[model samples]
Every structure is written in structure tokens, then in C-alpha cells.
Target: MTSNFRSLPVIALLTILSLPLVVMYAFTLVDSITDAEPGSLIPSEFTFHHWRFLWDDTTGRGSVWIATINTFIFAGSTAAIVCATSLTSAYALSRLNFPARRFFLAGVIILHAFPTITLIIAIFLILQFLGLFDTLIGVIMVKAALELPFGIWVMKGFYDTVPWEIEMAGVQDGASRFMVWRKLVLPQVQPGLSALLIFSFLSGWSEFILPLVLAPGSDAQVLSTYLAYFLLDDSLEVDFNLFKSVGLFYALPVILIYLAFQKKLMNIYGGGSKG
Candidate 1:
């Protein structure tokens, strides 16, 4: 009871600080489903007109569902590739002692330090050379490659936390190195794995610039790119309500994913090694 009493001020302070965001989100939600007079903030009447893009190609670029499907595929593929490669590479980095291991680790950090925008022109040219420009698979590969350094570093930290005894025990029992890693080490770092998976998925899902710059076709359009069409179109009078609805639609999956795995996401920093 005393702890609760003591926490009241902190809770109240947080609530006060968050009030504007809360109100803004509330207003957005309300505004999406309701009509407002020009130059007026208050919603005047409820309507589903703004949400028609769900079924209609109102943007003329493509159906919202196509963008959604592409977004899902991009995010899901990136997450899968990152997780699979990160786990194996991190295990090797943590458990193996190859030449230039430290140099490799240093290089990983250096690679991650460079911003994505700086590499875009080179990546764009490389994709063009490979005949992969403006392709979904091309963008997926780029996103996964850019994400790998962070994924490998984080997974290595988690791998460092796993005890050698468990792995040794498996080896002593006639298990191969692959078997030990798959059955023992993998299970121990489940939290980090789950967290990394969710994080990578969220990263790919929210990525705007890469998809916009790389995969501009309607066939490869992701939600982030699709959402930008509304703001960029000069032909249509600005429809703020429709924009809000589309924004809400784009954000719903991310919100749901975060809410569902919030605990695991929070654990990302808990077990990782500093070095």
C-alpha cells in the first residue's frame, strides 16, 4: 500500500506528460471515422468514406491490400533471414576461435555505424547491375544485409551469456557440435531470439526510405511507400481524413505486434553483453 502510494506521483507525472499524445491519437482516431468542416478541428458527423481505400484503388497507384501483402512479405522475409543467419553466425562468433575474429567483430560494428542513406546510391547501382533494381526480392536482400550487423552483434551478446557447460555436456554425450547448438544453446537464448525477431520485423515493416527509393513499382509497393502517395499527389485536393485513416491502417499491425511481444522486446537489453 505504501509502495502504491509512493508510485502515485510518478504515475500521475507520466499521465500528465502523455496526455497530449493520448489526445492527439484520440483525435486522429475520431477524425478518421468522422467528417469535419473545413478549417474546423471538431468532427461533425461519422462516416466510413475515408476508409474506402481498403476495398477501392482510390490512390490510383494500387490496391491497399497489394501494398499490405508486399509489406508483410518484405518484413517477414527480412525477419526470417536475419534470425536464421544471425543465430548461426552469432554462435560461431561466440563459440569458435577463428583467425581475425576480433577484426571481424570490429568490422561488424563499423558496418553498422554507417547510415543507410549513405549506402543507397551504391546499393541502387549494384541492384541495377544485377538486374534487381526496383524488385521486392532485391529490396528484401538489401534490408536483410543492412540489418545483419546489428542482429549478429545482439545475438552474439546473448550467445555469450549461454554457459559452456551445457554445450560441453551435449558434446560429451556423443552429440555433434551442430546438435548441441541446435538443442542446447538455441533454447537458452530464446528470449534474445524472440526479441530480435520482433525487432527485425518491426524495422522492416516501418522502413520507408528504402522501399520508397528502391522498389517504387506498384507490384512491390509496401505500406510505407503506399502511405507516401497520399502526401505526394498533387492531382487530388488534400484529404486529411483519408490520410489519417490510412496512417491508422498502416500502424495497426505494428501496434498489435508491439503489444503482443512487448515483454520480450523489453528483454532485448537485459541479457546482452557490453563487449
Candidate 2:
């Protein structure tokens, strides 16, 4: 009780520190709706001109709808591929005996340790060689590949926590190895699976550098690239409200996804599977 009471000051301090970020978001939100001049505290007038761009993209480059569909494809495919491959790779590393297994486990984390920027040149060259450059499918492959190392390590951690006796019991009940894995082992790591899905999806959703460098222009643009286009196009007449509107629009999907799966995020760090 005393400790709880003593923590109030710390909490108050943290809240105070967070005020600037809250104010910034509030300002942006207000700016998106009102015809407020840049750096003004109050709006001169309110209008929906900023949001109207969603249905009617006036930039004449490409439709927001197309970019949105492309984003969903890129993010969804990246998550699915990363989760699927990571599950199998992590399971083999965690449950099976193989030479250099520990080394490989360490190696996956090591691969994640290198900064992604350093590998962009190599990735670009590889994609070019494979005839995948400047295409959405190519970007999907690159994003999935980048996400694999972390996903494998996370799933491996969860897999290591599953009891071996469960698998043996399934085997004793005339279940094949694949069946045991599918039925018993996989459910034990549902939390990890959920975490990986959200992480991989968000990673691909917000990825800027890869999409900008590899899959540029209107044809293969994702929401991130789409938002950037607003900045590039507004040189002569900068519309801060429009930029803020685009920023909010780009972030809406990720926000909704997180809200939908926030409960499962807590489960990721919680204890092992229930009976």
C-alpha cells in the first residue's frame, strides 16, 4: 500500500513528460479538420477539404484506393509468409536434433543484429538479378525475408516452453509427428503466433525505405510511399492540413489492427498455455 502510494509522483512525472506528444497529436488532428494556418493555436475555419482527398485523390498521380489495396497485399502477404516459415524453422530448431542447431539459432539472431540499411544495396541487387525490382511481389518477398530472423527467434522461444511429454502423449495415441505438431504443439504457442502476425504486419505496413527504394512510383506504391508523395508534390503550395490528413489516413489501418489484437499482445508475455 505504501509502495503504491509512493508511485504516484513517478506516474505524475511521466504524464507530464508525455504531454508534448499528446499536444502534437491533438494539433495535427485539429489541423486535419480546420483550415488553420501553420503554427496557429486556433483555427480560422473548419472544413472537410483535407479528408475529401480520400475519395477524390486530386494529385493525378494514382488512386489512394489502389495504393491501399497494394498496402494490404504487401502487409498481409509478408505476415503470412513470415509466420508460416518462422513456425517451421523455429520448430525444427527447438524440437529436433540436428548438427549446428545451436549455431543456427545464434545465427538467426545475429542476422537480425545487422542494421537493415546496410543490406539495402545487396537486397536491391539481388531483386534486380531475380527480375523482381520495382514490383509489389518483389517488395513482399524482401519484407518477408527481413522479418524472418526475428520471427523465428520469437517462435523458437515459445516452442522451447512447450512440454515434450505432450508430443509423446500424442505419439502414443497413434498420432503421426506432423499431426502431433499440428494439433498439440502449435496451440501451445498461440500467443507467439499472434505476436508474430501483428509484428510482421506492422513492420511491412510502416516500412518506408524498402518500398521507396525498391518499389517506387505510382504503380507499386504502398501507403507509406503514398504519404511521401504528398510531401514531394506540395513544393509550390504546401498544404499542412492535407499532409496531416494523409498521415492520419496512412496510420488508421495499423491503429485499428492494434486495437483489435491488443488483448493478445498481453498474452504474448504471459505464462505458458492453459490446460
Over 56-75, each residue of candidate 2 has an lDDT whose tens digit, in order, gives 96877588889989999999
Q: Which stretches of candidate 1 lie over 4 Å from their true place?
A: 272-275
Candidate that would win on lDDT? 1
lDDT against the true structure, each candidate: 0.92, 0.88
Q: Candidate 2, which ten residues in sequence have the lowest lDDT sum?
A: 266-275
Give the worst 10-residue stretch by lDDT in candidate 1: 266-275
Per candidate, the number of residue pairs that clash is 0, 0
For residues 130-184, what per-residue lDDT tens digits would candidate 1 score against the true structure?
9998999999999999999999999999999987888899999999999998887
